[model samples]
Target: MREVFPDAGFREPVEAAEIVEAERRLGQALPTDLRQLLLESNGVLGRTRVATVWAVDQIVEQNLRFWSDENFAQLYMPFDALMFFGDNGGGDQFAFVQKPQRPDVFVWEHESDSRR
Candidate 1:
């Protein structure tokens, strides 16, 4: 992260320590790729809502939607806002997730960035 994006913001380890512990309690692993991408590229990568590497998936059951933005957990907002979009199974791309509370966007089953 520090090496890739010099301007990327950094949360003191002490500040993020609790968040890390919480992830452990939930029995979930923060998406490593997504985290790395954000740390490497702290700023928004590409066009807005044009599909960089991910998308806000609401087509499925609302509860079933795996990716979301926790800050806007109110049920109507974008999740992949902070990360870069890659590729997805349905001809879409993937995105990196910053926090655990929000649903992170990623390439679906066999989707690839090239498809986009």
Candidate 2:
């Protein structure tokens, strides 16, 4: 993960480890760049078309842009996060999604989808 984000600095290395461990616990392997981008940053960045899962008040908000159309939304059991499942082309393109569902979850609407 460090190799993936050489310049993304964090206040503490332990926090980065925590993020990696959290990903492992969730059973969701994030794209290296995106994961590194998120993990390395203190919070969401601004003005990018790419969707993000913002950390807000004990919950996370997600916005998805650019995912395989074949992949349908499904509940990622136990983790309480939505996931897209499909077998098709792979690209740097990703459908940004968030985790830890709640009424206050991050998003303009309760849910949304878009292509990057």
Candidate 3:
């Protein structure tokens, strides 16, 4: 994170209890690197003050909506396999593949509803 944003902003570190609950609610363990990052900072702010990474609570809320919201299903492909964590500040969002459980991250462009 620091490498990407030297002047990045960070919130207070997340507690272990919080991470445990978040994982439970999400029905899956968080990505290892993301979990570690959350332990160091609940969230990260980047250029133009965009939320480069969301807080744990936000992660839960946003994912819940993406994964189960019927409206989203009608508009786009299933989100059950992606764990979103951030955005590019222009509607494009970032996520990790959850079904296959890969270490690499992916970006979902809102306009095209594409992930790559």
The top-ranked prediction according to TM-score is 3
Q: Which ten residues in a row have the lowest lDDT in candidate 3?
A: 1-10
Off by over 4 Å in 3: none
lDDT of 1 by residue, 13-113 (tens): 22244335534543344466544433443223232323232321221212123344363355433543333344323444354444444565543333222
- Output the TM-score of candidate 2: 0.33
Q: What is the lDDT of candidate 2?
A: 0.33
- Model 1 regions lying over 4 Å from their true place: 1-27, 47-64, 67-106, 109-116
TM-score of candidate 3 against the unseen true structure: 0.96
Error of 2 at 61 (Å): 8.1
Candidate 3, clashing residue pairs?
none
**Tens-digit lDDT track of model 2 for 1-116:** 34663432333222666556645644565445444545555333223422232322111122132122223335211222433221112221123344542222222121243222
Q: Sort every candidate by lDDT, greatest first.
A: 3, 1, 2
Q: For each candidate, what TM-score against the reference?
A: 0.27, 0.33, 0.96
Task: Pick the winner on lDDT between candidates 1 and 2.
Answer: 1
Poorest 10 consecutive residues by lDDT, candidate 1: 55-64
* Candidates in order: C-alpha RMSD to true structure: 10.8, 12.0, 0.9
